[model samples]
Structure formats: C-alpha cells, structure tokens
Target: MLITQPSDLDPASPGPITIAQPLLDHLAAIRADVLASLASGEPVYGVNTGMGALSKVRLTTDEQKVHQRNLLLGRAVGGPPWLPDDEARAVLIGRLRTFLTGDAGVSVELIQQLVAFINSGHVPAIPAGGAGSAGEIIPLAHAFGPLAADLGPKEGIALLAGIPGATGRAALHAARARRLADRLSEIGAGAIAVIGANRGPYHPLTARGDDVLAAELTRLRNLVGPEPDPRSLQAPVSFRVAGPVIAHVRRTLTHLEAAVERAFTGVTDSPAYLDGEFVGTAGFHGIDLAAHCDHLTAALAHAAEVSTARLHRLLDPAVTGLPAQLAHEPGPQAGLVAVHKRAVATSHALRRLTLPSAIGTAETSNGQEDVQSFSWEAVGGLAEAIRLAREVAACELLAVHQALALSKRPVPPGLQELLLAVANVVPPIEADRPFGEDLTRLLDSVL
Candidate 1:
C-alpha cells in the first residue's frame, strides 16, 4: 500500500509498503537542511555530539562519520524472542511514519531502503523481550541497525528513537481483538439459544445510549432469531450481561485504535528537527499505547470470565435442564467435565496477565534515560490475552454445541448452521470419548 497518511495504514494487512512521493520529497528537503546545519558547525544531538549523558561532549568530523553506525552496534543488546514478520513490517511502517513529517532529518535514500526492506519481506531480528529502555533504542537498534550503514547526520537517532515497536504491535493486536469480539458474538448467541435464555436483556430498549451495545444486541438477536420460552424468569448473570461486557471490549478497542492512529501520525523522534533547529522531544514515550493495551487486556479478561462461567453453567443440569455434565448418562460418562478444567486454567492465566504493565516501570541508562514505560511488555501481554480469550471462546462453543444437541428444546433456525458446523467437528457426547480431541478439532473448525 502507498501510505500518505495515518488513516491509509491498515493494521490487519501486511502487504507491500511504499512511501508517498510528497513525503519522500519532504524528507529530501529536510536532509538538505540537516547538511547545511552540520556544515555551519552547529551541534546536532546524536550527530556531531555524544548521545544521552554525553550530549554535552562534542565529536570530531571522523567520529561523527562513524557515530551513527556505532550507535546501532552499541545498543543491540537484546537477543532471541523475535517479532513475527507481519509485526516487524508494522513496526517498520510505524517507523516510516516518524519520518513522514520530515522531523527525523534522514535522507530519502534511507527511507526508501527501509521501505524496500519491508517490501522485500526481510524480518529484522527485533527481540520481543528487553524493552527496558526509556525509549525504544534497544529494540529499534536491533531492528534497523543492519540498515544503518551510509546513514546521514541524524539518521541514527531517527532509527533509534520512537515507540514504533510498541505502537505497531498494539495496532496488530487491536485488529485481532476486534475479530475475536466478532467471533464471540456468534458463540454468545449460540449459548443463549441452547439455554433458551430470555431475550429481554437484549431487547431494543436496553441497547439505548451505547452504539457498541446496540450493535452487539442486534447481532445477538439476528443470530438467536426469535427467543424460545425462557428457561427461567431470567438466565444466568453470564448470559444476561454479555452484551455490556462485549461493548466494553469494543469501547476499549476504540481507545487502542485511537492511540495507534496518534502514534503513527504524530512526530515521535527524539531530538526532532524543527524549522532549522534540532530540538529534543519526549514523543518516544509510549505510556498512552501501553495503558490502552492494558485496558484492552482487562476487557478481554472480563469477556473470558463471562465465557468460562457460561460454559460452567452449560454443564449444570439445573441451568440447561439437560443431563448433568452434558453427558448422555450421569454415572458412567465423564462428559465435558475435563473441558471445564482447561477453561478454568486458561481463565486463571488470562486474569494473571491483566496486571497493568505500564505501572511496572523502573529507571535505566545512568539517569540519562529513566522511567521506562514497558510498552513492549504491555503489547505482548495483550497478544497472550487474546490467545487465551480465543481458547475460552472455543470451550464455550463446545459447550453450546453439546448443550444444543442434548436439549430436547427446539433449536432456532438462525442457529442451525452454527450447530451443524460445530457438530461436524465435535460429535455428540454419545459415550464420552476423549473431549480434548474434540476441543482441538472444534478450535480448528470455529477459529
């Protein structure tokens, strides 16, 4: 894609990337200005002067020539646990956004090379761990350092600066979470139908005041079709509260999406060039992205909590009015008792990951760079949370399908297709052959 602005970038797509011509021309102009500033013996941070604590110290012309490449070498301290190619592409794209405003003082050639690297499908070995720097120097160095040769005055600082790593990963996760939320709609509807839950909570009146809730309510009603006779006056809390919980996930997803847009559009290079001056900036700090990732993590956990609880309720003969454990017979068959254990374990792990990563900060870099944001860790946690959430959703799907099969109640026409699909992979729990295999197959079928 030829990206001219932040809105042009799609987090879900990792196709070939190209910079817009206007931005390239802008980069050329900025590079010329940087050369002029260097010619006049002006001290540009990370160019003619030492970096960080040594910023006050000046360098000779020879040292200046080699400093840019050395900067990369010195900070490539992290190892192993690399980002996947798509994520690496997003990070490079995010880095390209930093240069789009012409504040990074890098040559158009350097930008073109970076774009070529992304388009070429070259995955920079950026460590997923060791995001301990106040800024992104450690991971950025590992990412762009290989391309650091022949760099210009401020190019190294341009490459070393910014939260592209965190923001890019967050953008990808936000997209994944959105898809998971969509899938959960189908699963939630299936569960409601199987249990003959009241549609009163999803009535049009309750959807008022929140657009996400309204949309989810509509989706549920469509998937569930006309409601059956209520199993009771009210279904369990997990079923009744699903609309709002999913709305909360969607709401926090909006927050993450907004933060990602801001990160890509805004200038994030430290010591950014502005109107012929090299000025220091804190745009590299990524607490905004980290905090929003944390929020989404928490939201997914809430959704999972509801999902697992609903799964447990599905097993209750009292709730579904089916045989205990959704089994063919209570005494001889184990039914889905084992699946609930896996969901419980997965739910516990998901909850443990909800701790705010942004709050787990510390100082580093001899006080020159301190107060780390732990943005990378937050994005990583969000990725794992999404994984676990999907697992929980898969477990719910198994229960829903099993409950639908066991119940004598009429299945909604809207849910018939879903039931057929699930039943194909997960056969009826006729005699309780290993259900772990069923869950694995169901995950493949549904997810």
Candidate 2:
C-alpha cells in the first residue's frame, strides 16, 4: 500500500513501497516556506541558531548546514541490543507518516530516501535502550544518522522531533496485545466452563452499558455454549471477574489506538510553520502515547493475575473436584504442580512491571530538557508484560484441559473443539513428564 495517512499504517500491514503525490507536494511547499523564512533573516531555533542550551548562539549560513549534520552524529548514543527488524521497520514507517503531515519541512529527496530504506529492507541499528531525552533523540539519531549527508537546514530537529521509536514500538505491542486479549477471552471462557463456574457473572444483565463488556459476554456465551449447574454457590473472584478484566484490557487498547494514530498523523516537529509564522511548541512530547503504554501494562498485569488464579483453582482438588495438581494418582506422581509454580512466578513478575514509566523523569541537556516522557521504557515494559501474560494464559489453558479430562464429564461443543485443538499439539497428561515443549506448543496453537 502507498503511505499517505495514519490509518494506512498497521503493524501487520506490509510496508509501503511508494510515497503519495500529495505528500510530495506538501513536503515541497514546507521546504519552500522554510527557505523563505531563513532568507528573511529571522532567527529560527534550529535553522540559524544552536539547539538546546546553546540556542542563544547565532550561526552563519555556512555553519548552519554543518550544524544539521553534527546534530545527527552527536545524538547517535544508543546502546546495545539493537531493535528487532520488524520494530525498526515500524519506526521507519512511523517517521515517514509524520513527514506526510508536512510539518517537518524535510525535502522530497529525504522522504524518498526513507521510503527507499524501508523498501530495500535495511533495518537501522537503533538500540533498545538509553532514550532519556525529552524527545526520542538517541534512538532516532541512530536510526537516521546514516543519512546525515542528505539533511538540510532545520531538517535534523524535524527528524528527531516525533517520538517515532516509542510510538512504533507501542503500536506493534498494542496490535499483538489486542489479538492476544481476544484469544484470551476464548480460552478463558473454556476454562470457566471446564471448572463449572457460575454463569450469572457473564449474563447479559450484568453487562451494563459498556460495549466492550457486552461483546465479551457474547464471546463467552459462544465459547461456553450452555451453562451447567453452578459447582459452587459463587465462583472465585478470578472466574467471576474475568469478563470485566478482559473488558478493561479492551478499553486500554482503544485508547492506545487513538494515541498511536495521533502520533502518526499529528505534526510533532519543533518550530512548526503555522499561520505564516514559525512557532515553538511541545508537539514532540510523548506523554500521550507513554500514558497509554503504561495503562496497557497495567491491563496485561491484571490479566496475568487472573490467569494465575484460575490455574491455582484448577490444581486444587477441593475447587476443581479432581485429584491434587490434576495428578492421575493423589501422591504417587507430580502432575502439573511445577507448571503451576512457573505460572505463579510469571504473574508476579508481570505485576512488578506495572509501574508507570512516565513518572520517572530527570533533567538533562543542561537542564534545558526536563520532565521527559519515558515512553520507550514504557513500551519496552509493555512488551515484556505481554510475553508473561501469554505464558500465564498458556498455563491456565493446560490446567483447564487436564481438569476437563479428569472430570470425564460431557463438555460444551465449543470446549470440546478447543480440547481437540489442544490435544493435537499437547497430549493428555497421563504421567509426570517434561511439559515445557507442550506448553509452548499449546500457546502457539491457540494464541
């Protein structure tokens, strides 16, 4: 697809190979405006003057070009563990989307080069850490430094302005998390039915006016098929509140989608040319996306907690009406006891990752850059949280399948289908054996 607007950029969508003509026109117009402003002897922040704490220092026309090159080279301080190829591709796409808004004042040639970079499958070596600036200067610089020779007046700051690294990473994580959230709903419903949980908590009457909750109820109904008699008067809170918990994660994904869309479409360059004048603003701030990432982390943590609790319920004989740890024999062989312990550790680690990274700030760039949005860190934490949540969900699914097998009760058609799918990769746990590969295979098959 041709790159033109924010909606065109999806994490799962293929990268664009060509730039739209309208975007090219906008870039030309912006470049003309920038040149005219410089010719008028107006002292722009990055065009004619030094950046950050040195903004007071005036630069001659000849020195201004050199300054732009230096900006890219000087800011390339990203550390080890380069971003993955897919993530780097996302960052490049995000950066190109920002330029399409025509606020960056970059030349058409520079935009074409970026497109060519993506088309050629050349992933920039951007580090996964050390982005502490007000804007994503360190990572952006590393991603764009190779093209410094092509940078024009004021283009360096424009290139570094938008929070592409954080925004792109967040977009990728949000897409994956959203897909996993939906699959979790299906798997969770199967688990609930296997344990004979009360259906009142997921009844339509319980779904207030929230659309997400209503939709979750419908999905639960489809997966659970028909409600059996309640095993206990009231199921555990984890089982009862599963619908609400998944609803919360769905809400967070909606907010993140909006935030990421804005990051792609909005003009975030400094010294934006608006209303026939260059105005300095905080368009580069990444708090909008940072806060959304933090919320995603919290939502994933809650899901992990619920999954862990459900796994615990499946292992208890009193709760599941099965042998301890779903063991074929009570005490002769250890069944899924070790798997439950691993789920516990995974959930606890995810809970620890729920701390918001936006709150951690420090003064840098000689105190000129204060109150940073640690958005990159927040997205990184969210990625880890998603991984742990998936692992926890995998454990819950394994336990639920085993519990259903031990009960020897007739299951809903939906749950029976799920069991058959799981059985394809993971056999019934007859005796104690290494289940590490089984867990991985189950997660891959279902999620």
Cα TM-score per model: 0.94, 0.95
Q: Write candidate 2's Cα lDDT for 1-447 as tens digits.
A: 875654565654575567678768867987888778778988899778998999989998789878888888999977789888888888877787777777777788888888888888788899888988888888999999878886787788878886877787888888898889877887788778877887888886778888889888877877787666778878889888888899899999999989988877666778877766788878668889989988988998988888888888888887777899999886898889889999999999999998888786899879898888888788888888888999998898888878888998777776677678888898878898898888999878876
- Candidate 1 Cα errors over 4 Å, as ranges: 408-424
lDDT by residue for model 1 (1-447), tens:
887754676656867877788767867888898888779997778888998889899999899889999999999999988887777777787777677777788898988888788788778888888878777788899999779878877788789888978887888888888889888888998888878888999876788788888988888888888765687889999999888888889899999999988887777887888888878888878888888999999999999999999999999988888999988888898888888889999999999998888675666656887687788888889988998999999889888877877786666777777677887777557887877788788777766
Stretches > 4 Å off in candidate 2: 415-418
Candidates' C-alpha lDDT: 0.84, 0.83
Model 2's alpha-carbon lDDT is: 0.83
Question: What is the overall TM-score of model 2 with all chains considered together?
Answer: 0.95
